[model samples]
Target: MIGYLVLALLGLFVVAFYAGHRRAVASVEGDVARLHSRPSQHGLYLALLSCVPALLLLVLWSLVTPAIEASIVRARFAAEVAEMSLPQVQAFIRDARAIAFGGIAGFPDETKEAAAALFGTLHGWSVRIAVVLSLALAAAGYLYGIARIAPAFRARHMVERTVRGFLILCSVVAILTTIGIVLSLIFESLRFFQQVPIYKFLFGTHWSPQSAFTGAGAEEGAVNTDIFGAVPLFAGTLLITVIAMLVAAPVGLMSAIYLSDYASRRVRAVAKPMLEILAGIPTVVYGFFAALTVAPFFRRSGEALGLDVASESALAAGVVMGIMIIPFVSSLSDDVINAVPQSLRDGSAGLGATKSETIRKVVLPAALPGIVSALLLAVSRAIGETMIVVMAAGLAANLTINPVEAVTTVTVQIVTLLVGDQEFDSAKTLAAFALGLVLFCATLALNIIALRVVKKYREQYE
Candidate 1:
């Protein structure tokens, strides 16, 4: 119904725009420059004046209507629901609303049926009232705006102001959303810490969150108190990320240098896209490749060396993840390196430097900041990866630096904790948020370091 009303408002906007443009043109005798604003501006002003109020009302109605309906329904059946708990009454109201909307009630009752009928009647009346009020308001606003559409009216200025406000609103919304997410994570993590000691979660060397909620009517003692330690998850995540960077950084950097300087235009044209194809492939496909092919190969190679490698090991996941991130490092670094001033290379050559020496000393120094930023981006990508780790590195929170061992990352554990149906208030569930908070912090710190490094190198280059 609100959708229909919004569509109707859109139709009215078209009408208002045409009407206002025609009136403005006639008022100015088609000499638009003489007027303070153009016919288009006049039309836009009319449309906004006619539609914005009605749209706002519709939004307000949508927000307030449910609570109003719930209250009225509760009052209508107050005696019948007097003995019910607040949750029960709320459930009944919800069921009644569902029934009114043509859904079958799962638990039917006379009071609920009565309330549902009352809801249908009240909702119909509310819709009728809202329609009349919105249409009348739109009509009044349309007429008011048209009356004010004089030759000297500053309609363009008004539209610009509205546009500015809209942009600010968008920015504010994005900022607030980020703040809300951080606050929610912090609040949930605090609740988790209340149940599980923060020291144990952060510094302890064990992890088995399942023990947190193992049996019915369990006490804190039943929760393997030693198991909530997150050091292993952090260690695994870092170890995998390190391996990925070790693979990606040198190879990707060298590839970028080759494409940017060494390769012929024809070779670059073909090779760049082929190399970037790695980025386009889905991570799940990589995971499948890692699990089926890479892990087995690593196992066999390790066996040949008599090195007892796990079938699913950090080496397999990290290597595959590194392959996935290579294109990011290659493509971004290539672009950044290409952006370096050709004058620097020419200056180095003029000073009797070889091509390789000029590239190494002049071009690389200038492009170092962007290259560092690219590597950091690739590292973040590697850290947040889940499927590749889950499939190739089995979900064991091993605190070892050994790349041949099975290990799970923080992201994998966060997904594992929140995957199934579970109580949100439970320590087990809230631990996901704690892990998320830690992960967010780690990523944030990496970004800060990247920014600082970029700033320092950029200053030196400048």
Candidate 2:
């Protein structure tokens, strides 16, 4: 019903726009120059005036109606609901709503059925009243807007103000959302620290949160401190990220340089897209390629050389993950390199520098800030990647840096720990949030590095 009402409002706005447009034209007597605003602005102003108030009212009604209906139903079924706990009563109300819509998840009493029928009837009447009121409001707005559309009307100014207000609202929402996420992470990490000591969690060698009690069953100091150690996870994450960067940086940068400086127009057109196609391929597909192809190939080659290689090795995962992220680095670097002023390259050439020297010393230095930003972004991506690491590197949080052995990343562990309907209050589940905090900090550090890098090299180019 709400969906249909929204559609009706949109249809009304469309009609109002065209009607207002024709009325504006008639008022101007085909002399558009006489009007302070264009016919389109008049149409837009009318549409907004007709629709915005109605939409706002509709949203408020939608929020209030459910609470009002639930209150009435609860009042009618006061005796029955009073016997249930608050949570149970809330669940009962949800069940009643579901029953009213003709789907029963479970059995209920006759009083509940009576309540549901009354709930459905009340809800139906409310929808009808709301829709009628909405149309009336829109009609009133249309009349007011049409009367206001004169030779001296400032539709464009009104429209611009409305748009600016909307933009400010969107900006506030985004800022609030980021603050909320950061606060949630901080609060959850604080809870986690209360259970496990921060020193042990951050610096201890092993990670076995499963062995520790997660809730009130835990005493003030009863939790296993050793198992909560996060050093291995952090180590594994850094190792894999470093390996991925080692693979991505040179290859992506060289590709960018070649494409920018040497590749012909026809070749660049085809090759650039072909290289970027790697980014479009799903990471899960990359995981499969890592596990079945890269891992096995590495294992066989290792065996031939009489070296010990795990079936799922960090080398395989890192290499595959690197291959997956190459497009990101390459694409960003290519754009940055292309954005460097051509005159700098021409000056370098005139100074007797070869094409290679021109690119290496001049273009690259100029594009350093953007390229550094790109590489940092890619490193963040690599650190957060879970699929390829899970499939190729295996889920053992090994502290060693031997690429031939298996190691798991923080992201993979977070996923593994939260795979089922586990109690979130448990230490094991809360560990995911802790890991998330660590990941957040790691990414934050990378961003700080990017800023410092840009600050350091950006001035040199200028």
Candidate 3:
């Protein structure tokens, strides 16, 4: 039944779109032999008119239906429980509501009877109300659009303006969503800082989030232990990121250089996409390989060399993350290198510089900004990566510099912080937001620096 209604709404929209287009073309053709805009634009204009309002209605209805049904059920229960004392009635009502929603399995017999009746009525009314209103709105929009189509109608211009508005709206929505995310992080971090002083949280050397968990009868003046020191986690993140950069930058840059500067058409064709296939592999698969394959090998090798290696080592995770980011760095670097004028390379060759020297002195310097941007992008990916770090890097949050000794990262901390049963207001959970804010700021700063470098280099060449 729902599917049929949706199909009917769609069919009405299609009809309205065709009607608006035909009217637009007819009006324009009568005024002049050639229309100001193409007939396709007229069709698109009508399609937008036909669909926009009805789609908006459908979206609005979907969002509100559940809330409306819940309210109706709650209200019904409130009325039914009026005879009982306030506290007992409230408790009974809460349990009854939970039972009705399948949250709890059993309820008092009287409460159950009342709840079932109320829920049935609420569900039936809400569904009928939503379907009727949605269809009516869609039909109304179609008819209104048909009525407006006439000989003097400027449907082409109207449609173009509507399309422009839609594009602007989409862009605004994206920007607003980003702003909302940052604001949410800021607010949550503020709550976290209220419990753990911001200064201590940021610069503390130990990262035992368990310190935030207080036990019964814990002394107030005694060291309010739950080591919130974030230094080791940050260090682990930086160390792994550096390792990834070391692995990815040289390899990705070399590949980009070959593709952009040296590779023949055949070589480029065969190799570029093949390298991209690395990016397509799921990070979870990389996580498995890190945990199951690489870490054990590193452990055995370290033992042979008379060194201790943690089973879940940062090196294994970092290497795999680097492999994951190689395509992003190589592909972007290749495009930017290719975009550099051919004349510059030719001039270096004319000066009798060897190809390698020319590449190092001329091409690389010219593409430095773009290369920096690619590296920064890779760094951002490394820092934000969660799955590989969580699976391979032990969650102990050790405050150590030794890569072979298992250390955690900010992302890993965030995962463990909120993964299990957690209260939203607890210091442990809120710490995730604080870490997120710092990570966001760090990545944002790197991106800004990369952009500045790219801009400066572009100016130098121009």
Candidate 4:
């Protein structure tokens, strides 16, 4: 019914737009210059008036009708509802709605049949009233808007004002969403810190939350907070990120320089897109490749060299993660390099500098800030990656930096901690939120540093 109502509102909007447009043209005797707004603006004004109010009405009616039906049905079946617990009563209402709307219902009885019948009747009347009232409101809005349209009507002003208000609303939503996330993280981490001290979580060496309880059948809040140390996870994250940067930074930057400065136009066009396709591939696919292919190859090579390597090691995951974020660095660095002014290159050439010298001395210095920003963003991407680490790097929170050692990252630990059915109030579960808070702070700091570098160097070049 709501879908049909929406389609009806759409048709009314089309009719209202045409009517308003023709009426405006007739009022001006087809002389567009005599009107304060364009004919399209008048049409849009009428369309918004005819459709927006009806859409809002439909949304409001849809939201409230189910609750209204439930309330009235519960009142009609008070005796039946009074015998059931809250969950059972809620289930009974769900079953009644399902039967009324044509679905299999659990625990159907005579009382439920009567309730379903009553709900169906009420729902029918509610939908009908909603449709009639919505159409009436849309018709009234069409009339009011059409009546107001004239040679001197400020339709464009009103439309622009409405659009500006919508943009402001979107901005406010984004800001509020960020604040909500930060507050949730802070609140949850504080709960975790209440059980585990902040000093232990930040500076302790062990990272075993599974053994948090001292013994069997321990009471709540009796956790061995010393095992909640995060140093190993922090070390593993830094190790993988460093390895990924070693792979990504130089390769990505060199490719970007080649594409921006040295490659022919045809080669650039083909190669850049092909390189960026890596970014579009799912991270899960890269995880599978790392786990199934790269890890084994590394193990075999280590064996041939008479060295022991873990089957699941940081090297495989870090290398694959680097390959994944290559596009982030290459695409951004290419754009930054290309954005260096052509005049700088031209002046360098006039001074008898070769292309290499010009790129090294002039273009690189100009684009240095943007390149650094791109690299820092890639580092953040590397830090946040969970799939590759989970697949290729085993979930052992070892404090070793050896590339061939099996280690876990903060994101991977967060996933491990939250995977099963567990008590949210326990330090084990709440530890995920603390890890998340730490990860958030790290990435936020990287972004802030990137912005600072961009600002500091941008002035010298500009």
* Steric clashes per prediction: 0, 1, 2, 0
Tens digit per residue, CA lDDT, model 3, 173-232: 999999999999999999988888887887888777766555434475333434777888
Clashes of 1: 0
Q: Work out the TM-score per prediction.
A: 0.88, 0.92, 0.88, 0.90
Q: What residue pairs are clashing in model 1? A: none
Provide the global lDDT of candidate 4 against the true structure: 0.93
Point out where model 1 deviates above 4 Å: 102-106, 213-223, 262-282, 296-311, 456-462
**In candidate 1, what residue range of length 10 has the lowest lDDT sum?**
215-224
Write candidate 4's Cα lDDT for 61-133 as tens digits: 9899999999999998998789899989899999999999999999899988999999999999998999999
lDDT against the true structure, each candidate:
0.91, 0.89, 0.80, 0.93
Q: Model 2, residue 253: what's the lDDT?
A: 93
Candidate 1: C-alpha lDDT: 0.91
**TM-score (C-alpha, index-matched) for candidate 4:** 0.90
Model 2: weakest 10-residue lDDT segment is: 213-222
Whole-structure CA lDDT of model 3: 0.80
C-alpha positional error of residue 330 in candidate 3 after TM-score superposition, expressed in Å: 0.9
Off by over 4 Å in 3: 1-3, 23-37, 79-113, 214-226, 460-462
TM-score of 1: 0.88
Better of 3 and 4 by lDDT: 4
| lDDT over C-alpha atoms for residue 272 of model 2 | 98
